[model samples]
Target: MGIDDITKKAQEFLGDDKVKDALKSEQAEGVSDKLLDGVADAANKVTGGKFADQIDGARDAADKSVGNE
Candidate 1:
């Protein structure tokens, strides 16, 4: 399959209720937040903190997508 095909499949899987529920559980325990924080920190370091705000916003959006506030 192509990159688009893999992306589409991933989107479909993430859209499933079961998958969402699992993500929610992970978020509840702070797992996703920690992971996102690490990612954002790395991204900020890569760009010398120039895009920190945008990276943080993306991190928050990703966290919310998992089903939490």
Candidate 2:
């Protein structure tokens, strides 16, 4: 799938509350947050914000993956 499609699917899976809760645990939440932010920042820098929407989608994917949002 394309990046946007991949991100959409990933976000759906990350919507599970149990998974979300587990991801937000004190032990892992900090790392996950930092990782997502770093990845988003890197993408934005690399594309000069041309793909800001895609980067945001990826961020949503990460957030859902870690059950953060």
Candidate 3:
């Protein structure tokens, strides 16, 4: 299959009711968000605030990758 086909399939999975319910039940989104936020914050502090903006973008991309965005 092509990239488009894979993308479509992934979208379908992300939208599935069963999958959605499972994710909600497990609090996957909330947990992941909190965890990512903490990591980003720590990284920013470690870097002396040099990559705060870039870290936000990376965090958003990570969330989207896991169907949280």
* Overall lDDT per candidate, in order of appearance: 0.84, 0.80, 0.82
Query: Which candidate should be chosen as best, given lDDT against the real structure?
Result: 1
Runs of candidate 2 with Cα error greater than 4 angstroms are 1-24, 67-69
Give TM per candidate: 0.76, 0.58, 0.59
lDDT of 2 at 9: 88
Instruction: Name the weakest run of 10 consecutive residues (lDDT summed) in model 2.
Output: 60-69
> Between prediction 1 and prediction 2, which has the larger TM-score?
1
Q: Which tens-of-lDDT digit does each residue in 20-39 have in candidate 2?
A: 67777875767877888898
Better of 2 and 3 by TM-score: 3
Clashes of each: 0, 1, 0
Please state the error at residue 39 of candidate 2 in Å.
1.0
- Model 3, range 1-69, lDDT digits (tens) per residue? 999999999999989988877665547777878888999999999999999899999998887655344
Q: Quote the lDDT for 37 in model 3.
A: 91
Which TM-score value belongs to model 1? 0.76
Instruction: Pick out the ten consecutive residues of candidate 3 with the lowest summed lDDT.
Output: 60-69
Ranking by lDDT: 1, 3, 2
Best by TM-score: 1
State, as a TM-score between 0 and 1, how close model 2 is to the true structure.
0.58
